[model samples]
Target: MTGWARSPLKSAAAWALPYWTRGEPGRETPSDLFRVLYLGWAVALTLKVLGSSWDVSWHFKWLRDDLAPPHLINTVGTVIVVALTIVHGYTGYGVDRTALRLIQVGTGVFLVAVPLDLINHRVNGLDITSWSPSHMLLYIGTALMIGGVIRGWFVGAPEGRTRTVMLGALFLFCLENTWFPSQHQEYGVFGIHAWDRGEPYAEPILLQFAADQMGRSVDRNMVVAFSLPAPDYLYPVYATAVCMLVLVLARLMIGRAWSATLIAAGYVAYRVLIWPLLMVADFPISAVPFFLLGAAVCVDLAFYIKVPVLRAVVGAALVTAGSYLSLNLQHTLLDSPPLANTSAIAAGGLLLAVWLGGEWFVQRYRLRGQPTGARVSATATP
Candidate 1:
């Protein structure tokens, strides 16, 4: 007889007890279970990233459909994430209490956002902008969920090739999530360019709706408004202050000399690879963030400075300069969005402030004789 047929409660307790015991907070999990759990996490996150990427491109090409293929793919990823979250909660394998709590909270938020987002769509005509509040909640939840997974894997996995590879992959996903919202401007650049060439990519209906919302006729002016909705400053600000900060964190967490560069390169490469694929699938494409790699390199170099405050200042300066130069080059070569110098300076200042604040917090944390970062755990033998 199956374990359940013998006695439901007893069998359940028996099965759960070992997992609970084996996976107590800060305790190493069995090798097999560790691999299994984190591998599942990797797969689920990959699906979500892929789905979300396709979904954005899909939106640019067609009208919103609840049962669109991209949405279906994203739903499948969500289902897998829900299953993984349940397993993590029940067994506590591969995650500490803090990590588990983050995962739970994030998943809860994402689930709640789903129905709310649908309601938003029903009411708001077309939630075309990725910067909408409801959509941001989804991104926030995903960031939280991914952040938890990054912590769990960082702390629980023993130092080895496996850990390095897994952490790098996770950071790449994190970078992707961090940079996702900027894709609107990325897509918009090419979108307007295409329209100027008398070959707009968005469907006529989508263009009409977008124009209608702004009380304008469906013309070049409407397309310009629809395509480049956000101000130019927002893009560079996000690129310098927000996204590059993620690279800095990845460098610190991975504790690798080139971790930030590799992760940024991987993200850029993924975008490039997907560019042609999306076009072949008859979807809209966006300008890839080639400048990210240059900024990432500067971030890695800054980490070598040893002194926290000085490191932050120098790093922010380097990244700001490099990113501005790179953005200008891209604009010249590929007709990408030009980086405003004023915006770059503002973003750099913001980055420096945040970095200094982080250093202060870490110093305080150190003074308190508490662990500053994730706790390293030993791996248990099977």
Candidate 2:
């Protein structure tokens, strides 16, 4: 009886694997169908970043609406992924079941949170930070899903144009996630004064405290609470730490010259491409973080100068220091009121510490397995 019961269970699991993994009714190696489907998924995810940014901007600029353009863009992007998942089940080309199943779990969580977000907006209103429960869940989901896709490519992409192009896509996606918080923060700081006059959205209690501190009555609409200069180090410190994580991981995996440059170029391209578009659309704005190119160059050069552990340390320090000094100086010299003082030494130290911890973990996991980038050099990338 036990043997008969176990046999069916094993059969069921084996039958289900291909729907979530590779090997389908078509059964082609990196099948064209698979690639096309993945391409669609990647496009959706890329749009998600843009849509998410627009959504946040919408919150800052206008009243919260469930079906707002920003929300619709983001939601439809996610829905596309969900739809693709269903279509893949029918079409026999799933999105890298080869990677962590945790990503699927994340997507499920994100779907559940979608409706909850409407409830959140209705009750609490739009938020500026990623700390809110719904927002955090959303971030966690996309990050996991993107990460799984990257992992799947690393495991599956062949050595040729396919690998190169997909590698660039992965780098761009990683850099987008790494630098997005900084972009959002920049928009918040500048737009607070420009597009929406120090707008009050959420956290009235905090605004009330600011009002009390100023010896004035708290008016709900008046943005008197947010006019003060934000802490200059918050964005840089967090951004640098996250940047170190992604940069080090990608460099380790790819181990190629100009790996950091690839990410930097993608970031710069997006800013340049989108800045004009936003301008044409009459959206409020300021200059991009063009200084990141200098910072990314420093990290890339450092990777060439040193070996594994030392290079990691040096790259982390260089990236953080270069970004802090270059971007902060540009902001201070160009913008009104200027940004608050950035703690270069502290940010660098923080990134260096985080990178070192990550290095130890990588070694523990044996992830440095004989330089995949060297095997990959035969294939060139843009």
Candidate 3:
């Protein structure tokens, strides 16, 4: 046998026993095992992200098919996730008990959600909105699953470039999912504009179905309702309240100087890369949230504040102001909607509250007089 083949065989044979033995819970995993296991998770999640990106665009152009190519791509990722769950469950190698339970429950919830989603579609015929209850369940399950993986990787993987890179990548996926629902409006604006200009982006069947749901004919009004169902205020508020929150958490979790900026940049870059590809494929494209980079920069800067409470307060304000400006800039330059004054104020106040609450939780959770950085580092690889 070749030395290359022999080496892997030897490692696998050696790995088998401890894997089956289910060694002590929360036990320290070997660095090599940790790398391989978490890297698999990273790849699996990347596949899921790509599939979801395509799935959203696909829905805009075609009716929901049970066996669509995007669904098949997602299914492949789910299969890998299931296999990894089994390995983690049996081996206790890469995860502690709590992490294992999270993975198991998340996987179970996701599995259950799949059938429910199909049933939802069967009953409601062509429910394409990603904000539907069934779809939310899927997103929730995915969040839980990603949370478990994050916990596992954060605790298990030794501190290094590998750990930093993996954690950052995971945050990017999380941010994307967090911002996903907003795409409805982002795409809708463009779709409506295109329809007005003599070229409609949606297929006739899709427009017909949506119109039928509202007892209306396929016209401009129907198109407006079908495409831009959400209120304009929601987009910016969500950007601050939900998506920016994720970036804040990423900054905390990744524990790097520019982690938030890098992650946000990565997300925007991915969107730009796919935008042309989707256009070439004749699928609908949405407005990319370039403003996230501004907020992300603020998130990173927020950490430099020495006092936690003041930091959260000032940081929230900064993110809100910076992002609002960026949103306006994007609206002027891109096909995005104008930012509302009410949304900016509401977003700032809400973000401040959440940021303060998060700070209190961090302070209370730590041992007496323990430095905040120490507490943060305990959950993250520095």
Worst 10 residues of 3 by lDDT: 367-376
On residues 175-196, what C-alpha lDDT tens digit does candidate 2 reach at each position?
A: 7765665565656555555525
Candidate 2 RMSD computed on C-alpha atoms after optimal superposition onto the true structure: 9.5
Q: At residue 297, what lDDT does model 3 achieve?
A: 91
Q: For candidate 2, what is the TM-score? A: 0.75
lDDT agreement with native, every candidate: 0.80, 0.61, 0.80
TM-score of each: 0.89, 0.75, 0.89
lDDT per residue for candidate 1 within 132-155, as digits (tens), equals 888888888888898888778766
TM-score: the better of candidates 1 and 2: 1
How do these models rank on TM-score, best leading?
3, 1, 2
Error of 1 at 280 (Å): 1.5
Q: What is the lDDT of residue 133 in candidate 1?
A: 88
Weakest 10 consecutive residues of candidate 2 by summed lDDT: 373-382
Where does candidate 1 stray beyond 4 Å? Answer: 1-28, 360-382
